[model samples]
Target: MNQTDQLVDLKNLSPDALVDFLEGMGKEKFRADQILRWIYLRGVTDFSEMTDLAKSFREEISQRAIISFFTPETIEISSDGTRKFLFRLCDKRSVETVLIPMEGGRNTLCISTQVGCAMQCSFCLTGTFGLERNLTASEIVNQVCAVRKDYSVDNIVLMGMGEPLHNLENVVSALKILYASKGFDYGPRRVTLSTSGLVPEMLELGQRIKVNLAISLNATTDEVRDELMPVNRRYPLSELMQACRQFPLAPSQRITFEYILIRGVNDSQADAKRLVKLLHGIKAKVNLIPFNEHAGSAFQTPDENAIRAFQTYLLDRQIVAIRRAGKGLDISAACGQLKEKLENKLLGSGKESSLQGK
Candidate 1:
């Protein structure tokens, strides 16, 4: 059977499933560990690179199954050393991933979980594109593996193109792969999954995985939240807050509330006070991401003084707040700026050709 026809995302399969598949193919069970190491640890795309395996075994594996790793079709490095990658998926759908180099020897890989987004958040460009498809578990894992091959990733942020909790199964599967000792082995503390408050999945994730949770709580009030993020309308602020309070957290672990600082929108002192009330009793940190303006986006970043005042209010009230510095804006690959430009090019061409013929 052609491996591609198997419909198994090798990255998604558990270690036992991988072993079973290899053994069923008449390959030694020990080869499973080696294959997993190559795919996850070494990030090898071609079977030929599995030098530990015998040539004949490699050839057989190559004939039967192939590893898939996305190569960056476009790479852009910001002046500050933040690198953005536009990766081409196997199905020709493109997604963006970013590597942000931080101080003290830390690097974070921002990974996407879907081709486009279904959340339709008013502030997010990816949501404007509409839902394309959920990336396979392997596809999600491959972003980390492929990017880490070039950069030493010390942390991961599921804050790219799509709403991760919306693609819960694949997200959890990828998280398991990352946590697996036989694979990447990244500790749960090193990974953060951000969601626009998908309540059911949030509860499920809290039970299944212990990774850090970042909620895109752009607004504190239900009326404002509904205006900013449509997902809020379905899962109201009260219910979402209840879910967060119920979400299991270690004594030291605190949920991260990501609030995009859109000028004149949710930046007021009143909003900050309301936010404090909303987050009452739950251990949480606020990430104040100043809006990174993208073309056609209706929002604008709040001024420095306003941001400082907002931070000061949170700090005075004992709410931990960190300002997320703007990065990768030059490449339009920063937070909330991942619309597939190639698709837009194709659409534009179609329109031009149609006009010419008419």
Candidate 2:
């Protein structure tokens, strides 16, 4: 490895890679598990604090390796107890991570896989920045480790700034470490990756990672989806649905279809019926997310009646449907509201509020 590369971020290496590094240093390979437990499960980032290792060995590791983590630039907490963390990466780029606390003491962390998104979904705020860069596997897992250092995180959702499938390899590698018993020890069922209908990579993810899959299916028709999510123009609804039907799902695992209910857009009775038909064969549940408006966005959240009617339509049709309550609306931490404040800074506008009451 080059001199720069030799300053390896130990958090970036997988269990096997850790073992390889130990073996190369003439140390026992089993020490990799000890390190993994300290760094991942225990949220210990300092090698010197891993007291189980010999003092000399720890010194050697401290010199050769680094536990890299993003610098938390800003942390905002809403009245509803949702916390949003904006992390500044090594390249000085920023990504947002959200912690949504549920009623049953479940804390689900929504982490970013990229700095900004390439998928220009008309309603999303992150799409405004276009593609910045894909986050490395270490950067991805670092969000979890960083968050766990403060909060007890039980679930993880790849529903932040970027489309995860757009950076498939890094995401998959991070998932391996997160799922491994020697690492984060998070079960596959607790980890969910949401996508904007990247069919090929979605299929590949199913075959490779056993984590839960959630697809952002905002619009029912291809014409509408083409306009809302430009990715739909490439992977149309028919092809995406077909791929979903064929996806290798583990026993009792059902795909989650996230339907954002935009006012006068995709929340009509007819749209609800079509959504049911579209998800006819797939073992899926619909999460009806009422649009969370941000600064400079034209979309409006559907009325409560409209949202209820749409969800009711699916429920009556015997399809499992849930109207997802907007979390951290006051803090702009809900879906698509992240990064609006940063964009405001870039645009030189002092307008800060992103909450538009439903």
Candidate 3:
């Protein structure tokens, strides 16, 4: 069998699988737990660091199963204390992850699930990059492990480059690994998955994992949403709201609706009023994100006065809304601004650029 099939993502495997694999290699079953602690908790990269394990056992493990980790190719620190990391994956494709430091001892890590996005949101830079492939469960988990190893982050948001629901299985598997007591052990409440209203997946995720949910509800009407986010064409606003009603949220948990304010698009006071009506009786929080302009995007960020007026409209109706401000513009690492830089070496060497359109 190939390595991809025979070698499981050590993060995805249950304790039983680890014990079985270790026993097959002539090591005691208890050694599995010891090695797991070393990898997950201590964040040890070298087998030599696992001194408690027998040297022969460590050598055998090195020869059999591979322990994966991500090395950041580029790191950018925003003026607002936010950090973005460009990590090179096993397939040589690159993805970006961001770390945001919030007030009150809260830190959020925004992770990407795909190299590029298939959901072509009109204003998103990532959508312009086009689709590549869904990352393996290991690739997703390695992102968290890598960020945690390097920095102390308190929360996780699946809101970087690609749509999390599109890569549902792998994303959930990665979440399980992160939630496992033997692994990262992050509380489900601290992790939030953002989707562009994939209704079927939303229903399934609501039933399966009780993690926090954030919906990218940038537009109040179907006409506007379909123009901004193409996914709205498949699953319209009505159906999405119905799914939200069925979503199982904890007593104190309120669904977060992400609204990106675009000039001359969906930033009008009427849009804000319509949004308030659409979310009536549903426990929700609105995150007003001023559009971050990119090279090819025709949209511009909403004026400061317009953004404040919209925030005031929502608050007047007792709807909670907060503006999201963070770092990333300088290095193209902000929300919807992560794209891997392609080198000119291939072009100079008479090779077609694999990352040309993507």
Candidate 4:
């Protein structure tokens, strides 16, 4: 093992924990805040760049700790201004992050919580790889840090590769850092975490954090959801809906239920009605995503008419619904959709034309 590999990752430490850590090292609490500001706010990596810290303190910590960031192995940019970053972690395992930009100055960055997902959602490509390992709090936070350095990311969604609720502890730690005034300084409204309806974690997250919560609820029935997402079998629709209703939200905020409209599977007007009834009492909005067809996927994207009808039914019933426009299709922008190992698989096949890296 290398020397840096054994060093403690400063990015993994939360604000209070960081202060406690510095105090144990014979440093002041304010110094921890300064280090956070320099690392997260100022994007400084080197200990020497922390000008406010004394030379002795900097040198001492530099020998025992490190601030690590994922230098993206490749960055693929679509014509529509959507950028996908394939990040290789310290373990040599890879993860992906996508940056989706919209008009009216909205830029949302999608980050992962795990390298691959265990949820095994039928339509999602990321889950096929199975669970590799849960990402550390540092790995999750570093995705935002790496992207923010190059692009303007105002909104963050924990929805790229894995189920956010699966890695609850690290995810919560990462959220604390993201919202810390001394750290990323992101407002609660500016960040959203999507989960595959992990019932227990949903309640825990509600009690702890104030960020927007999104449920990857692709179906209205327990039978359908079970086949679509394995998690539904464990925490059925009844439990999931109860948890959603109980999920605390600000008066102005609504829990976003992401319903991927798969043709003939869950895109019917009948299904739409079931969804409205299911979300009847809860403060909710629906993001209607037509399935993005990938290779070897049994699911097909809903026809334009069917998709419109589903959204119309919800809108007619006083439900907030919007059809998410597809972006970055050219690059197979969805993580785990293009290649098995991003760097190795494509190089052998010579399908590099689709992926333009920066």
Better of 1 and 2 by TM-score: 2
Candidate 3 local lDDT, residue 238:
92
TM-score of 2: 0.92
Best by TM-score: 4
TM-score of every model versus the real structure: 0.90, 0.92, 0.89, 0.95
The Cα error of candidate 1 at residue 332, in Å, is 2.5
Give the RMSD in angstroms, all C-alphas superposed, for model 2. 4.2
Best by lDDT: 4
- Give the CA lDDT, 0 to 100, for residue 277 in model 2: 87
151-189 per-residue lDDT for model 2 (tens digits): 999999999989999999889889888987987789999
Q: Which stretches of candidate 1 lie over 4 Å from their true place?
A: 1-3, 7-9, 23-30, 48-60, 336-358
Q: Per-residue CA lDDT of candidate 1, range 79-144, in tens? A: 878888877776566788889988897899999998888998888888777887999888888888
Ranking of all predicted structures according to TM-score, beginning with the best and ending with the worst:
4, 2, 1, 3
Model 4's TM-score against the true structure: 0.95
Can you give the lDDT of residue 194 in candidate 1? 93
Q: What is the total number of backbone clashes in candidate 3?
A: 0
Cα lDDT for residue 122, candidate 4: 84
Tell me the lDDT of candidate 4. Answer: 0.87
Clashes of each: 0, 0, 0, 0
| Candidate 1 clashes between residue pairs 3 or more apart in a chain or in different chains | none
Identify the superior model by TM-score, candidate 1 or candidate 3: 1
Error of 3 at 131 (Å): 1.5
